[model samples]
Target: MSVSRCDIPLPENFRPEDILAFHRRDGERLAEQVDDHGLKKGLLWRGLPSCLELRFQPGAARLSLAIDGAAAADDAGRLASLGRRMLGLDQPVEAFERQYGAHPQLGRLIAARPGLRVPQTAFPFEALAWAITGQQISVQAAVSIRRRMLQLCDCRHSSGLLCHPDAARLAGLDADQLGQAGFSHAKSRAILALSRDAAAGALPLDAWLDGVPVEEISERLLAVPGIGPWTVSYALLRGYGWLDGSLHGDVAVRRAMQMTLGLPDKVSQPQAQRWLQDFSPWRALVAAHLWALLQAGGF
Candidate 1:
């Protein structure tokens, strides 16, 4: 099959560093390892120095953008829209400050980080699959599992990008093969069930981002086999950009929040809910900021 690519102009302030930071936070580097599994590389179109090369696979998509500091004059409106969508410009920073003022530490920390918004990403399947790979495992072990899964199931695009396995591909695998790929029995069944459901159109994983209520979406996600609160919450934040979905049960998040808030011990779920009340509609962004802070040695 022939490959196609398209380029879109990015906003003037679309810094590569910012994209790198968000991608790093969402574990995009790990996704890259699985790119050759089944992802397809499409056409290459350029908008002169500020173009984005779009890649579309069966169940995932990503754009490789070339940041141009000098091309700001060419695509102002497009850039503005991109900026609004990506930088949380739609959110009122003042409102965020007003609501979170009681937790000065959280507010001050976010204020100091200008580019702390959760990135708009297109690969829900990749995000979900990664979350499963991470279940009850260390980050290093999760990475290894993901790498092995990709190696076992991935196909390469002409551009050498590794595409993650499609649902049909994964659904066809038996339990033993999945176990050989290092997936525990429960995880293997869950992954296969999700893949089969996705392939059969039973799960509208991609459509939940279109202004659906957070609780509704969370409930639907939880109905899937093997997906729990933490998985759904992570998906809400990473896949659909639901800012209010606080992942209170996440070990890393709980630890980070405790340290950041100077709590003597890990905050309980109820306490976390109360503490996170101020973040409200933008709690996901706050979580992203806290994660970044944790990674940077603040926690």
Candidate 2:
């Protein structure tokens, strides 16, 4: 197996654990996908022919990134880019804390985990596929299904680490085929349809959707079979690193907001949307940190 290693520089106040926390929050093994250390995320970089298993660790001023089983000779640049994006290395560490860090609810978690950074996948297609698989289900249930589906269909490197399948591979499967892999009819159709679009180059891939108007991008992705407001917002938040996307419709978002604000019951979607406006520019960070709060037992 070919191995390539690089040290990607980080912005100030970056902590590796802060980003890995998001990966571990579900607590279930994604078909033995995530463990105590690094995990796999798929990427078809510059036509590498197959996905590389990327595992990274954060350090004092840089991330120690390794790509095990990579085939491309010049894949280092792509790996560095993905490392920066996945680790939230571009974020100004103190900006959010400086602005809303002292708030009664948000402050509790922020003060304790000052380095909690919002992490994203290396690309959009995998994030969208995961969002579809995870829609409207309990985290435990969704992860169970994902674990099954990935084990059944995704590509695995020699290390036994699997990468979520690419559009070309997934596009060829029928809904009935995916049904056997723990997908509901709706999710099956969504996955197949999205895969087809992506494989055919009809939908945006990776950073292609970046810098497009949020409304325009939303319209395009919502046109997919299973994408909705929550999925779109969730995808944009992690997929494009856009902090403007709100998690108002997410169950976790509502639950966290309710407990943080001490509300009697779950807030309505409209209420959640309006309430999230309080965090406005940092809504995506707010959502990640709120989810982190649950993992940290703050709520």
10 residues in a row with least lDDT, candidate 2: 60-69
Model 1 residue 276 CA deviation (Å) reads: 1.5
Q: For candidate 1, give the lDDT of residue 201.
A: 80
RMSD to the true structure for each prediction, in A, is: 8.4, 3.3
Compared with the true structure, all predictions reach lDDT values of: 0.58, 0.70
C-alpha-based local distance difference test score of model 1: 0.58
- Predicted candidate 2 versus true structure: per-residue lDDT over 1-299, tens digit per residue: 35555676555556666555556644544322444456554344443323334354464323233334445767666666777777776666588888878888888868877877767766788778878988888777777777777767766644455556778878877887789878999999888888898888888676474467888888988899888888888787777777778888887778877888899987898998898898888887788777876763111
In model 2, pairs of residues that clash are none
Please write out the lDDT profile of model 1 over residues 159-272, one tens digit for every residue: 444446666677888889889989999899888888888778887665554577777876766888898987876776656656777667666676778888898987787777
Tell how far residue 56 is off in model 2, in angstroms. Answer: 6.5
- Winning candidate number (TM-score): 2
